[model samples]
Target: NSSVSCHIVQVFSNSDEALINKKLPKELLLRIFSFLDVVTLCRCAQVSKAWNVLALDGSNWQKIDLFNFQTDIEGRVVENISKRCGGFLRQLSLRGCLSVADASMKTFAQNCRNIEHLNLNGCTKITDSTCISLSKFCSKLRQLDLTSCVSITNHALKALSEGCRMLENLNLSWCDQITSDGIEALSRGCTSLRALFLRGCTQLDDAALKHLQKHCPELMTINMQSCTMLYPSCSKSQMTALWFVCLAAATSQITHTHTESFIHIACVFLRILEAARCSHVTDAGFTVLARNCHDLEKMDLEECILVTDNTLVQLSIHCPRLQALSLSHCELITDDGIRHLSSSVCGQERLQVVELDNCPLITDITLEHLKSCQHLERIELYDCQQVTRAGIKRIRGLIFNFIGCCVILGVNCVLFC
Candidate 1:
């Protein structure tokens, strides 16, 4: 039926119902058009009068990701799209589209009431007004990404909480203006929330974590990277010191925390947790996390310097579904920690990625212990000065991928191709 459009111009006018129905009917053709990207769809719209009508169908614009047009997308274009697609638009991503502001989003929200997944990350010009509009209109909204939307504050969270009750996943990463009050409001209202990303939201302390844990019990995934105020286990003095040091360095990497529903490892609930660079986080914090989040499949504890081998023991014993772990820069972690992880149930069947980069305490013996992790695919040991070629060669078979890792041994450096 690929050639059914050969008589494209005359097909629409064909009086024979059977002849037209047997050929590429409008519904099936639109279904085929649904797969095309914006550029190709536009080209198809220019093919002929028949194709133009078929191609411009709003049903085919239900899910649109304009992330590629970050620099080129204009507010006029966005407004035009809102009118053209109207209620047919369900999911749209204007991620990094700085040109489109509150005006365009207001129009969009009014037109696309059924919008479920909206990514406004990097739309810095937008403020609480946009959220109010979305709250007033888009009740069906599910996942909302406001990453790097600096103008967003507690007021925005308040609006979203009041309106978008169905919201399940939200990314407020790098929104420094939000506080525990906002989080509490969001947690209380969005009780069905599962994944929340708050990396670099330094104002959020342990109080915010408590709010999420108490209200959002269904929460399976969270990113608290660079959220130094999270660890309540640290003493006042330690917390103050960590607050100063971590915040000073938080802007170093220009990190972007994605709240995109954490890796869906388990069909039941994708339990992924990331607390990387939470320098003040002690073993007590991780112990609580491991106990409560037993289904945790992926965890990033990189630079959580206060964590010791006890943290590993807790994870190994409780979190049997752990598949990926990053212990980079956790100097307290020794070979024993790796052994504890490698001997666990996760190591036997689920463990896949182990990043131990910059852990000076670990020697070549850590590699030997990792051999027990049958499913281990990548082991990061890039800067363990004590590790020799002999030790890496011993466990090289277990770690099959060397794409992002290399080791320095003596005068020679081993690079994986």
Candidate 2:
């Protein structure tokens, strides 16, 4: 025991000398510490007094992703990180950090004024006040992910609109309290906004979208899934399922809607659009989208029950860049829809992902159509009862998918399988 203690002291003495004596420059040591993750940096801090200063230095704290420590992370940790990181903190993800609250975030906004990207996704404890702090201080903020932050309301969007003008991407998914007022304010101030995700903001009507189309010309990606009252029919007093102007009732031909608000949003050259579960969306809505958003690369129409082969025809004819398309649960999508999509220039060249889940009508003929899709990488056929095992095995490289990569296939089979 005595010999072991003596060896430990000698090792510490050598380590101290090695650290103090100019064996490695301080700048180089800090640079090396910069490469270390949060957990490793914290461990290195306990190594020695010199190591602690290097590990905790503001320059080394520019980017931090605390998703791994979501459950353990508290407001105090954020406060300390803010104090240490200061304006040097550029990007920090507090996603799923459930315990982080407003007070610590206020301190963070004040201290880390230069922060450009901050993710508070699932941090539901904080209210609009935290955003007020950000609006006052963190004006340089660009991207913010507030997914499932149910407490956030119109006030926070108002604050952000007034202060954070440079904001490009924002995810307000499941923030049900946000109304058209907040969206209008956001559209007016943050015209530079590119991508806006408002999944499940059920209250916003067409008037809210009119504001976005009016101002945000640079907008590319927009997701307004499950906003039940999105496309309000003037004839009917009640709200409707078409939000994000996402869909309309199926028509034999592609016809434009008379709704002024939904028509205007077509000006946005969006690349990625996910309007899943807007069940009422039909050919008219898809036509408007396909005609306007020629740049649309990916679209999710899952559970859009009213959608038919006509929507597919419009997409293939217009959206030449169409790569990924989801028609899952749209039972109206017959083999002809797949045939039209796969035969076109967009289908053969650009089409990569096609999800036909739960569409009972599609037979082996649908698989035959998809064979021409040279770039087709993934096809979600889960619960597609008509498609048999023989049909799946007939496709080239789909066997490889069963072995590795993307989703597996089968009707009445496990999702991952």
Which residue pairs clash in candidate 2?
248-281, 248-282
TM-score of each: 0.76, 0.82
Error of 2 at 119 (Å): 1.7
Per-residue accuracy of model 2 over 1-417 as CA lDDT, tens digit each: 999988767655654554342577889889898898888999988877678778899998899999998999999999999999998999999999999999999999999999999999999997999989999999999999999999999999999999999999999988999999999999889989877888778777667766776678677656666676666332322112122334322222222353323544454455666666655556887787688677788888887788899999988898899889888899999999889998998998898888998998988898778777777767788887888877666654453333332444664453321
Candidate 1: which stretches are off by over 4 Å?
Answer: 1-24, 231-271, 279-296, 310-319, 394-417
Q: Which candidate is the best by lDDT?
A: 2
Model 2 scores what on Cα lDDT?
A: 0.78
Q: Over 4 Å off in model 2, which ranges?
A: 1-16, 19-21, 232-263, 390-417
**Deviation in angstroms for 127 in model 2?**
1.3
Worst 10 residues of 2 by lDDT: 234-243
